[model samples]
Target: MSNLIHFKRDELSFQPYSGQPPERASICRLIGPDASSSMGAGLACFDGCSIEWTVLYDELIVVLEGHFRLRVGERVIEATPGDVIWVPERTPLAYEGDQARVFYALYSVDWQARNA
Candidate 1:
């Protein structure tokens, strides 16, 4: 891998997340085990969709545009541009947004290994 990788959002291929409700939710993997050994990074966008997930790894999310909301257990938190949220492993979270673009990084080398 190169020391630096450049990406133009419009040029990246984003796939609809099959695990989530297919209501304009898409993700593009920017870095993973294929790119790095320490962590994985990605960009995700959602609109008018609420989805639940059981996080298997520590994750840091930064809102890039619009409002993004997350229901972590009993706590509800809203994040906007420049806002950052950290979610621990083994947490159950519900996410929803009107229109949001987020950049996320997971502190795990292999999420499937821990999840499975």
Candidate 2:
């Protein structure tokens, strides 16, 4: 397998999210197991919407624009630009915010397998 991969700015195409409260955000996947071995990366933008999710793997998210509120059970974390949020597997969480943009890396090889 090749060791080099690149996603140029022009190559990114954000599409409407299929998850709950679809209007909340759009996502553009950059890398996945189809391109790598054990991890995947993507870009997401949210606009004043919240979605409850159960994570299946470890995830690292970095805010790039605006702010985001992550509710993990009873704990709520406010994330701003440059902030990194680490979410562990099997955690039930809710992501909500207004005009938020983030970069995320998920450590899971079967993400696509399950999502697909």
lDDT of 1: 0.85
- Tens digit per residue, CA lDDT, model 2, 1-30: 677877887878988775635468789988
Superposed on all Cα atoms, the candidates' RMSDs to the truth, in angstroms, are 1.8, 2.4
Full-model lDDT for every candidate = 0.85, 0.85
Candidate that scores best on TM-score: 1
After TM-score superposition, the amount by which residue 77's alpha carbon in candidate 1 deviates from its true location, in angstroms, is 0.5
Off by over 4 Å in 2: 19-23, 112-116
- lDDT of candidate 2 at residue 52, scale 0 to 100: 84
TM-score result, candidate 2: 0.86
